[model samples]
Target: MDKCGSAMEFLENKNILITGATGFLAKSIFGGENLEGSTKCQETLFTVKSSKRDDSFGTQLIEKCIILIVKVIGKDLFQVLKKMWGGDFDTLISEKVCLVPGEVSLSEMGLKDSNLVAEMKNQVELIVNLAATTKFDERYDVAVGTNTLGVKHVISFAKQCPNLKLLVHISTGERGGLILETPYKLGESLNDIQGLDIATEQRVAEEKFKQLEESGASKEAITSAMKGLGLERAKMYGWPNVYVFTKAMGEMVINDVKNNLPVIIIRPTIVTRPSTVILLDMLQVTVGYATGKLTCFLAGITAIIDLVPADMVVNTIIMAMVAYELKPSNKTIYHVGSSARNSMRYIDFQRFNYQYFTKKPWINKDGDAVKVEKVTVFNNMTSFQKYMNIRYLVFLKGLEFANKVFCHSFQDKYNDMKKKINFVMRLIQLYRPYLFFNTIFDDTNAERLRMDIQKKDRETETFLLDPKEINWEDYFMNIHFPGLVKYVFK
Candidate 1:
């Protein structure tokens, strides 16, 4: 096949049903409002910076003028055109791409329109199941209802689809154990519970939920009970959390129902915008004024963070979909992560943060520059808690005591601060496990697929999905960090 033909043929006229169509990956694929609000300023800044290389003000001026024109024309018109043209802002939106609005957790995927569901069953060729509850501490009932039962619904729908070619179910990279490129039977390992079938396990979960409901527990109490149940089940099953446990159950459902059907499970690790604090700091140091040193201490400084840019993860999804189409497989599992290919050490990440902050301080909303003197990295939880207690907790407690004694009205403010501190502490506890995670996902299958595409297709066709081509430092400093600051922090 020719380059373009090979790359676009599979997706070309293939009716696809993307469950989580409003999510980040779907938005990038279909085009949506990811670049609004404070991002407009970042967009202008990026344009001006690009023009600097050519030493030309004309390019910058033109971009600014275009921005003004866009404002006058309104954002809605621009968005319509952008969506119609797709990501490149040139190619027309694939005629075959159609949005199916429904909830995955429902029986018929929450499809109110029976005709639409029938049409999907008749016409849809590929079903990309990306809908799932991603919360780490989600309640057991909600997690299983959405993540586990949701998969069963999708599979039932897929089974009805006469032309169904592939079912791409998005899973997690962390399966609470060493993950291999090949698919392994559940409970095959020593740590896993033996002979715990999905049907029996699901029944047990439902029975427990029913008992809780029958007990006439308060809503909050029921929720807490469910959460506790999920944690207990996960621990018993050798899974990390309710989210992963339910997701694994979802995969098992697919395995059971998807007889003789082509299916691929993609397990993606921490998907986040790259940290750009260092790059922004560098820019400030080089272009703006600096202030005196200020010290900042951070927890999880020596932890290892396995993260892949959201765009990269999306790219892998699309490419994997296409690759599966080209080479039909009964079952294939791909670990879409950067750990094996391009790992970033937490200590080094912190170092970059320190370097950036020390050189150029962050500007607050009030236009005051915050200086950075030094940063202390806490690898151990004990050290982190000690620092927090000495630096913040003790001081805050003193303020609270004074407010209670002298200024009773001001006590509310102190209470609010304490609540905020408690919130932060809870978040720290929630994410602490991931910060020190040591598993490296085996990506042999994914890498092989990339190589196959590289050999068969032109560089332009495969460049975006090529994981080996990523430069960790460059990507973090340029694209990831800048994007995070502009879109998220803003």
Candidate 2:
């Protein structure tokens, strides 16, 4: 039997639970949108049978596996599933997929219904925890609640499942230098801070909240203070931002509690969608350049910007899940991206953007092509600040002087331009660490997994997770850029 055959056999009739099904990456998992938002739907269970057989590897896997979505609260996600199944939607919902709504930050994922929770505990063999708050400067309480405590809740729930074979946790790799595929040991800190404890962090957040409440701080003030505290704590512990710090803590939580449970962490770098704010600043920059709003960029032209498509990451996750289940190895980390293999440098990215948009320019509301030019690149903060002052700030100062003398005729334009400048500067400050990052994620384990799969199957295209096969130029000029124009550009 081939590897694909073995995987299919292993997946047949298996019950799988996917948390955070309404998130950006999870939407790709179900191939749909959460039309009515992620919070509106409540606990509801569905027993669905495979709708139809397809040529794609994902659909093929779906045909064999029974997927239980635990966090899908609205019909929008299911509607996409319905569209994929067409007339068979009702039948598939009845026999193929299972829907159970719950929140991961809550204990036992907030599954208040005892009967449903017990049923899930008995039937669920595989669990994938993708629930996360990916903001870099998210409020301390919210970040700890979702990214850190949520992992604890999921692990606790997993411990109750007697038949659980594997728990795959979605993480990320965003630090600079040579990043290796390795598990984060319990209470480990990137800055080597001794005695890092998850419980202590939670206690600190609670105390801070109480302090703010006792002082009668306004909601806005509390929010601002919490955000600031998250950043401060993250920096104190040697992380660049709050998101990665909490995510690291999340891995710690899993290590602390997952005694004998089979767990694997998939740390993909900069997926096409910015789930972890790692690529969010880049995405915003791309949109600005494509629409002719951006004229300057701060980046090291020679630095590599690692990126993997969301579908590719999802494919890797599915394959990793099966590979780990079959082999049951102690190696828990896998970095899935195209940085060390087929790296895309900032220069090439800039060139691709210029080529794509210049040839096919964005049309404005006035029915004219928005001409785009190669943006002036500043490799360092000093140069970028000087350029900003000479180009935008000088104009703003002129506008400010003229506003007072000319009865504030240019007030709206001045304010708008000033706001844009301030926003861009803040973004640069928030993402300065990553802008010139020179990290190369070591993906030896990921490569070995791919090799093992292909060695048995021989036909590798069906499960294309290897990042070395991507042609950066073609992907950017054709697929990625066009998708941005159609979906993201205003």
Candidate 3:
């Protein structure tokens, strides 16, 4: 079949319901530059719930416009508007998209209006469950409620949808170590934990929380315990973090309950923007005058960063959705990542970061250029610790001594500086695993889908899914980094 014909056949007249529509991944899928003005689907329903209690009409309108601009026109355009005139542009996307107030964590997606829920069930053709807590150190109760039991609720809702043809579950490629484009069964022990069933698990988790509360446990103690439980449970299940562990369980639930329904599991690894949260935090620390102009410290960190641009991930998702819809599959798992196709090590990413900052040094409030020096790279933790002692700890001690000897009143300031440095170190320790991650996701299925697209379709379809086509250095330098600086860093 021709590309246009294939796309039309798959997406024409389809009503897609996306959970977590406000999230990074879903926004990329529906509002990516490639899909802009080329969305073949008839209508998209984004499920959302306002955290604000007194949300006014003006607030809603602004929220809607922001969604349209980011998910539709892309952030680059939004950044352009802010940069050009310090003004905003309105969107015409409301005509094609509908925002339905709902919460995925609740039953029936927390939709209070039964009629609206029924209407959605009757008309929705595709259901994409992208709602989940992505924080690695998320609390156990929250993670299980949203990521584990939430999948069950979505599956139940999908089963009720009379017109449902496809149900896509967005999972993490980092769940199983060295992910392969194949079915993975949780270990027997992990399976046993899952066998407790969603309801039972939810009850158990809640009861644990309640028991801790009744025991008069401190909030910090309870939080630490919950976090530890999540980590221990994840380790027992052979997963790395709570985020991936719960996501894996969510997939398991779908696999067990899908029952002949067409389902596609898209596992994407480290789906990042031009600048990731870590990079942003690092920049905030190292680019300031207080950090002694350490621009090259990030470059010294040696690790493999298996990252795929958010745009690339979204393109793959849209194409996969269309391809799977055109040819129904009982269950298909696609690894949409760059590790197996075009991998960029941490060192390379650091080099690009250093190069970018070196060319455009951050100007401090004092109107002085803060330049970065070449950093010392340490491979082992021992060496890193030794370097930290010599570079920062010793310097801090000297400062403390000077304050004590000369300016005794500056003790508070010296203590504050020490705390800030320690906090930064803690942040680095928290992100140590991801900074040094080495897992490679096998994207065989995703690649085959890219190749399967008809030449005619390839020409007409704006969204390209091939990871091999991506140029990492160019994308980071030109597209990603600039967007990050303008939109996020600004």
> Which of candidates 2 and 3 reaches a greater TM-score?
2
Go through the candidates in order and give the clash count of each. Answer: 4, 6, 3
Q: Write the per-residue lDDT of candidate 1 for residues 48-113, one digit (tens) a residue.
A: 012223333445445544543343223332465555445744323223233334556668776655
Error of 2 at 190 (Å): 2.3
lDDT of each: 0.62, 0.74, 0.68
Show where candidate 1 strays beyond 4 Å.
Answer: 2-4, 32-99, 175-178, 184-190, 195-219, 273-302, 388-422, 459-462
Name the best candidate (by lDDT).
2
- Worst 10-residue stretch by lDDT in candidate 1? 40-49
As for TM-score, the candidate ahead, 1 or 3, is 3
Listing every candidate in turn, what is its Cα RMSD in Å to the true structure after a full C-alpha superposition? Answer: 11.1, 8.2, 5.3
Per-residue CA lDDT of model 2 for 225-306, tens digit only, reads 9998898888877788889989998988888888888899999788784221111223777889877888889999998888
What is candidate 3's lDDT per residue for 1-490, written digit by digit as tens?
6433755466667899998877767766664455444444677888764443457644654675576455644544334333433332233354557777666777887766677788899999998888889888788888997898788789989999989978888888553257677654533233344453445556766888898999999999999888767776676655667787777778778777778777888888877762322121223433342234443243225456677667666666666777775676543888877778778886776577667767876555587766765555566666777778887899889888989899576788788989988876766664566766767788878777777764537553445566677777877667666655554543
Clashing pairs in 1: 275-481, 276-481, 294-372, 294-373
For model 2 the local lDDT of residue 246 reads 92
